[model samples]
Target chain A: MRHNLVLRVVAKLLIPFILLFALYVQFHGDFGPGGGFQAGVIIAAAIIFYGLIYGLDAARKAMPDRVVETMVACGVLIYAGVGLAGLFLGGNYLDYFVLDHDPAHGQHRGIFWVEVGVAVTVSGVMLKIFYMFASRGRDPE
Target chain B: MALTVIVLTRSRNLFTVVVLAGVYSFLMATALVALDAVDVAMTEASVGAGISTVLLLGALYLCKSEETKPVRKPWLPLAVSAAAGALLVFGTLGLPAFSDPAAPIHTHVVPRYLNDVLRETGVPNVVTAVLASYRGYDTLGETTVVFTAGIGVIALLRRRRKQPGAANKQDAAK
Candidate 1:
């Protein structure tokens, strides 16, 4: 992999675009046919592609094991926290209508955070699984 | 697509089978898009064809490439599979035709969601409104499920057969 100049150069050129596309899918999901889950997978795919081309160690350093592990939990916490926020805001559990004066805007705001949570957790889990598989049967640091 | 499946089942090499499965998933994603399920299509394409294939290939690296021949005749398993497939097809035969105007789904909660989603949530995509807002609890549950699965993987991998690094660290510290 280190010797393949073509593969390395092509991957370097493509990764940023792949990441940009993933972001598009994440935010544009409301108007189009994408959302948190799709975006998360796309994000993981880009990073996984990086790991494949560059090396597993490089990918792990780029997204450390501790950070990846934390992500697996943090995303869920963010989601549940949003629901708790709704409860504190005088709405029922998971209610979005009361977040703002205009219920529609509140819904948008709620959905955005929730989607962010989903994307974080999803990408975290996907990367975690990849790391686990890639690191199996190897010496650990 | 059927041809891909047939070839997949008949193939002996695990690597070929893995690649073929990815091809099968890609074709399935195409069919989903043709049915106007673009969101689901993206999911199938990315998760099914992309990530799962990569994971399978990774697993393949840890094991033999060729499958061992089974000693059994495989007749009973084939019969059971054929019976299940026939029963499933029979079950679908009683369902409404594709895109029927009066299908139970279109007449039921779907109409309400479609009519009120934009006004209620101000989201142009009804699917997003339904998945994230109207069915927020379900989506939260799904996220929790993913979290649980990830934790489970971590737990399984944490307990390694050997802890040479732990021993080495302790020795160096002492």
Candidate 2:
């Protein structure tokens, strides 16, 4: 794979667009056929593609293991935090209607943040699984 | 697609099985699209076809490419599976007909979501509105599940690299 110039070049050209498309799916979920889960998997697929072509070291360098671990926790925090915010705002748990002054606006804001949290957690989970499996039976550098 | 499934089951090569499983996922995704479930189709394509294939391939790297034959026949498992399939088919007889306006789901829950989703959530996608707003707790729980799974994998796989001389340090890291 290291000697395959065409593979390397094509991956280099494709990775960025794949990431961009993931972001698009993440944001456009409310209007389209995608959301956090799908977008997260797509993003993970892109990162995994990079790992497949360039090696696990490069992928790990791009996203450090410690940071990935933190991401896995942080996403759940964000989601629960949003629910706590709703409770504090004089509504039931995860009540998005009370998130902002205008109920509709609050709903939009809440959904957006929740979806973002989901996206982060999903991508983190996928990457963590990939890393664990990929590193198995490998000789440490 | 059925042919692919048959080939997948018959193939002894793990690599071929993984590849054929990916093909099955693509076929399922296409079927989802044909059924007008685009969101589900997208998820199936990305998670099932794209990521799972890569993950399975990574796992394959650590294992033999060929599957070992079982010592005993699989007649019991096959019979159980057939019984479960028959039970499921029988259960479907009690279900409301497809696309029936009077169905419980269509009559009770879906109408509220479809009618008030845009008004309340200010989002055009009812699915998103329902998932993120109406079912926020469920989504939160799902996120937590993902987090838990990640933690579980890390716990299971993240062995401390034993130093060449300090073999005792592995327990300390754990």
Candidate 3:
């Protein structure tokens, strides 16, 4: 019971800030100590906190297994698809210079998409691991 | 530090042991950050304090919490661990200093990324540029790790279904 309350209050307080900070890291990584990977873990940690407090079922209700699975696949797909796009644009694999006429712009576009992919995959993995561990016993409630 | 280690060693509670281990990890992470390895420090902080703690707690749930009294000296394992630690520190002495301008790590391909990645990639974040573009293949592997973990979770948590005849019989009785 105490765990539940702690989880609830912590989740409510931290999830929003975690998400906001993720965006900040995503955008301001060059100037700070964080990047997509760190932000992704932070977001996932928040969700995992929710799972620990509310039980696996409630957590699943909040973030369905299907959605998490799709996000995992989609992240990889998005990353590969961007590289393939560069291929179509007549460049080498992951060659962002050909993404647009302006090579610099292409690089920015490529990095943005890839970071999005990282964020998706990392968060999905964290939540999935939490779900696996949390669902391990018979109904204890 | 030695005193804390003695206290932790003397404690006979597994919960206290795990908590102390976490504190130790946090201290190690602090040292890493102070040494200017922010990326490694961040990874350690998340994996050590966040995920490992949760996993350890789960394992603790399925086990007796009390620590059994020591029956034998763990001298061999202690000696091996100490030797490994000494070897690691010794190895580092031969390596370049952190952020050294002339270090091979700083002078090689890394300089290219630091100097030109922003200008070439038009991305304000050079780390993102390197992670997403210059080293995309590595990122792909990282993503696959996540994909495998998700699948593993589903496999582990999937519920077993009752046999059709059993379910039908139960329904008829109801």
Can you write out model 2's per-residue Cα lDDT over B78-161, one digit (the tens) per residue? 999999999999999999998788998898889889998888889998888888988888888888898998999999998887
lDDT of each: 0.93, 0.90, 0.77
Of the candidates shown, which would achieve the greatest TM-score relative to the real structure?
1
Worst 10 residues of 1 chain A by lDDT: A132-141
Sort candidate 2 into its docking category.
Answer: high
TM-score of 2: 0.94
> Which of the numbered candidates is closest to the native, going by highest lDDT?
1
- TM-score of every candidate's chain A: 0.96, 0.96, 0.86
TM-score of each: 0.95, 0.94, 0.83
Pick the DockQ winner: 2
Comparing 1 with 2 on TM-score, the higher-scoring candidate is 1
lDDT of 3 by residue, A24-111 (tens): 8666755566666777787777777767766667779989988887887788888888889989999988788898789888887777
What lDDT is reached at residue B23 by model 3? 81
**Best of the two (1, 2) by DockQ:** 2
lDDT of 3 by residue, B1-174 (tens): 466577788898888877877787788789989988776688678777777787677667768999887699999999999999999999999998766789987767987887887677766556566777788889878887777877776776766656899989999999
Residue-level lDDT for B23 in candidate 2: 96
TM-score of 1: 0.95
